[model samples]
Target: MPCDKSANADPKKEFFIDVITMDIDYPDCILDLIDNSVDAYTRSEIDDPQIRVTFGEDSLEIYDNCGGISEHDLLNTVFRFGGHVAHDSTDTLGIYGVGLKRAIFKIGNAFEFETYDGVNHNIVYENDLSEWKTRDDDEDGKWRFKVRAGAELDQETHGFSELRITKLKDSYKKMVTLDAKIIEEISIKYVLFMNRGLSFWVDNLKIEPLFNFEVLSNEYLQPSVKLLEKDGLKVKIVCTYNPRESLRSEREEGRYGWNVFCNDRLILLSNTTKETGWGELGNIAFHQLYYPFCGYVFINSHDVRKLPVKTTKNGLVTSDNTYKFILNEMWNQATPVLKYLRTSRLMDEETLIKDAEKSANEKVLQDSKLARSNADQKSIFSMNEKASFKAPDMKPKRKELTKIQYSRPTVQVDKVKRKLGAESNKKVGELTFDLFYDEECDDA
Candidate 1:
């Protein structure tokens, strides 16, 4: 009599699936697919990179004219669970091999992935997740995607990888139905790409950048752009004011705060928390008082492993050494702007309005073209490793000023204001004071 010598130690595919897709949101699943397409574009020699996403009530379609998956990669690496094949030339956003499979399983039960690399290569892989989960493995007892060489694709689909997902999970269907929000998310997340000749479309409508990543740069006022380089990584930080926005009131609109990018993809947008050093010692707490603040931090490196971003590419690896250095630099660069914002509030209402108008018209950099035009100007100054333009110094108000206040009947106040031909109560008070000074004080 012998006891069972071994136990069932094999890992279930279901366990991996649950772990990978559990914490990810529906929109994030969509973004993972797009990140794969963008990585393809980055690694290819394609002249024009275009990605289109079409949403249906129960289905999703994403197509990209970036170079498609190679047959070698298709058979070896693309469908693998959790390893990355290094490409020396391309720095891409995909750190984990799970993005594609995770997205497919997160969105729907059925999927079709087809690719044509614009040469002689064409491959297609389609499967139902539920059946694949229950079906026995191949003779080799290995789980794998069954891919085959397919018919030559048409001109539109040539050089493109297309994915179609059906049977959308009930809980995730709302993400596709609310297409407008998704489009905005794409516009924000891919802003740098959009600026650099990448075209993205959703539901046949061309997507454009909804948020302008510009700041005021001129003779009177210029943005602070600081560059920090450490161990082959380059970080460029720009902090300044947006001429069109104000700090007078709180705004829930995701139009302000820090915008952080890694390898040209936006990882954080309008981030206003301690995670980005908002309430740190050197930086002011994120309040409506600092609403006019706009910042951009771009981190670029040839090694994707060095970038301080998680596998989701939606947040930072805050504990990363590079990120720690970046956080300190962000604080140092942001201190002056915060000081200016705080001091600017001391100005009187009229002076503040005039300053706003002047900044908007003469001093503000109107467009990206103007921003570039001023690049060679002497206004931009560099110190050591950081390059910056000086923020404006507000003229300090006189400390001897006094305020006069009194309550009067509404009828009397209006009548006196009319008699004095004044538009405001303060004007009427000023006129009455001057009359008394001339008639009584002078005669005395």
Candidate 2:
């Protein structure tokens, strides 16, 4: 006798939908949609790429000029959970193929997809969550979305595609209304693409890239640049100074420390933790003296799975071997620059003044240094091999300081402190030393 029975192991799609949306914040849902648009533009290699995000009272829309999804991909992969269409993932941010569906479900219960690739012009598809949840599994025991094609073109159909999600959930309603927060998040994540001429708009307001931190460059002060390659991963580390060191506003100070990117998308900004080797590997821990220190690490690979970014692409996979190597090399490249900063900052501290005019003059000097000829700056950035920063020879002549430590009777120290009118035992020692230096130690 043989048994031919199977236990039910199929996942409930309704529960799966809730599980995916549970972990993501509303702002991230919006960013996921923007990521899709940006990725589409990268894949198509479009010259005049543009993305627009619009919000209605109860709906949200995203439109992009990137090439529309091909009919085959849209029907086969786009709607399927965790289904990724094969393509070159280099310089791309989309991986799990769940961003779109997850974002759609997290935001609303109904959506419309209209796309035009010039050939498959005016294709429209619509779906509602309630209907999708009620539908039974098909013959192959899988849920499927019905796609409708050959719709008439609409007024807002200029771009390759436009997606509108309506009936936004109550939880996400206020999040979409925050125009500035959304714009700032987009600016941080896509500053590189914006620099490359891609324009993004939110609520008809164009997003301008936040000015990225740059190091100073001249004959005496050059930033170090190193290129590391291992296991199909390419990491470029640059250690330099923050040009705004003299006038570090709260915002500017926040930009100090390490900035890391993967495939041109920023993942870590101003990280000064031990994860990036701040207090590890015999390096000095982060302090006010290291304010001018800055490091940039950009990791790229053809096979993005080898990259050290988490699946959300918002954080790093610190446990990955590739990331561990990158971190070690970051410390290697940053050591020299940090050493120079320590020396330079100590000198600045010795001559420091609180005059506003002097601070303004320093700012002027910093600006002039930053205004060096573009050709000279290009030469530094053009170097791809191991290079060292040429620190200026500026160590001032000074008497070496020595710590004089000696144990004395507590009563005696207290008597000396009272005689000298000193506030501390250390101060009493300093006063006695000054008296000795003035009366006994003769410079004559």
Candidate 3:
């Protein structure tokens, strides 16, 4: 009897490609690549950081004048799937090193990286990617980039990286459309960077910092610090609430929420609902409340494991205790302001905050401190079903059934497989996911 051992092997090329491209659309993929460029600026502390994106008929490219990649990083870091990087900087957006590579595989079959530092200019790409994986281990497996004195790089932009994704894959050709929602999301996500002198351009058009909904009545409550001893977490919170008339009640919870940031990068764009921390604490019906609210929680932590984000970097795990503390803090200050907004009914937002700030400070501080203590586990302001009159649960009476069941009618679905129609390289009658193209952008 003998124990059998399996040999280690590289993942098959198609499986690797498919896994790399999962769970992200074109807009998110493009944004991931930009995150790397932003990290360069964060690391180098470069002033006047500029990111330019261009749309080509059959290709797309991203250009940034940040720090350029070196030979070692080009070969080992950038091209390597699942390239490992440690979470070294709290301020930098990049943690996982797979962003740029995944983005490339998402958009096109082959892409080129053109970069220049003060001394060297470099270019790298691999054609026929599938061939590399099939090559025998004994054959030379080394693949390195080409470096030269001048690589079509401008002298003025000495230190920079330019990524061009070309030869569009059949599945990703519609990425060129550039939807309005994508632009709005980018503008909101990067407003702080834009304010700090980073210029972001999309297809020769400059993206402006999107403005928040106007506040009617407001209050700048005393800032709060909550220390969760068991978790070793600290949250510093500042909050503002809109007046009763500021937001349309009919419009519901439209954009009234927390804009949470960790080390200055936005983690949760809008934490605006009961599950997001407002439900039990605020007590007021979310959709019925006249006043809208928003706030920020700047976090400092002893343990990086407690960070309130997923690897995708799209949003916070709002269910985490850290976010729950923040939402609760915002609600404590918001209660009095909402009460005033209802009774006083002020037209001017400025005067409301000024007035609320004077009266709410003491209560806000006491509640915030008490929340951290084990002695007072329950928030006094929060509502219980018995104390606050919640409607009694009544189960619906079951309908009597006797010989009433019948089988559903059979519906036939026509499934047709087709190839791309008259495409230069594709066979006739190629089928794509049926996306609706007739609907136009509201302004377009």
Find the candidate with the highest TM-score and give its number: 2
Provide the overall lDDT of each model, using Cα atoms, as 2-decimal numbers.
0.72, 0.72, 0.55
Look at candidate 3 and give me any clashing residue pairs. 216-349, 217-243, 218-353, 418-429, 418-430, 418-431, 419-429, 419-430, 420-430
Using TM-score as the measure, name the better of candidate 1 and candidate 2: 2
lDDT score at residue 49, model 2, on the 0-100 scale: 87
Assess candidate 3 and give its lDDT. 0.55
lDDT tens per residue, model 2, 265-327: 888777877767676665556765566777788888766677888777778988887788788
lDDT of 3 by residue, 1-444 (tens): 666977868555667667868987878888788887776666565777788887788777888888777666665677666664333543566556667877887777666788776557777775544454354444454433334444464557658888888877777765545646556666877766676678888877888865433222212222222323225555555444433334353433324566665545566665655545554542554432334444555564534446676667777676787666666665665555444433323323333334435455544334323322344232211221111111111112223644322233222111111111112211111111111111232312
Residue-level lDDT tens digits of model 1 in 151-170? 86576654779898888888
Worst 10 residues of 2 by lDDT: 347-356
Ranking of predictions according to lDDT: 2, 1, 3
Worst 10 residues of 1 by lDDT: 376-385
Q: What TM-score would every model get versus the actual structure?
A: 0.76, 0.80, 0.64
Clashes of each: 0, 0, 9
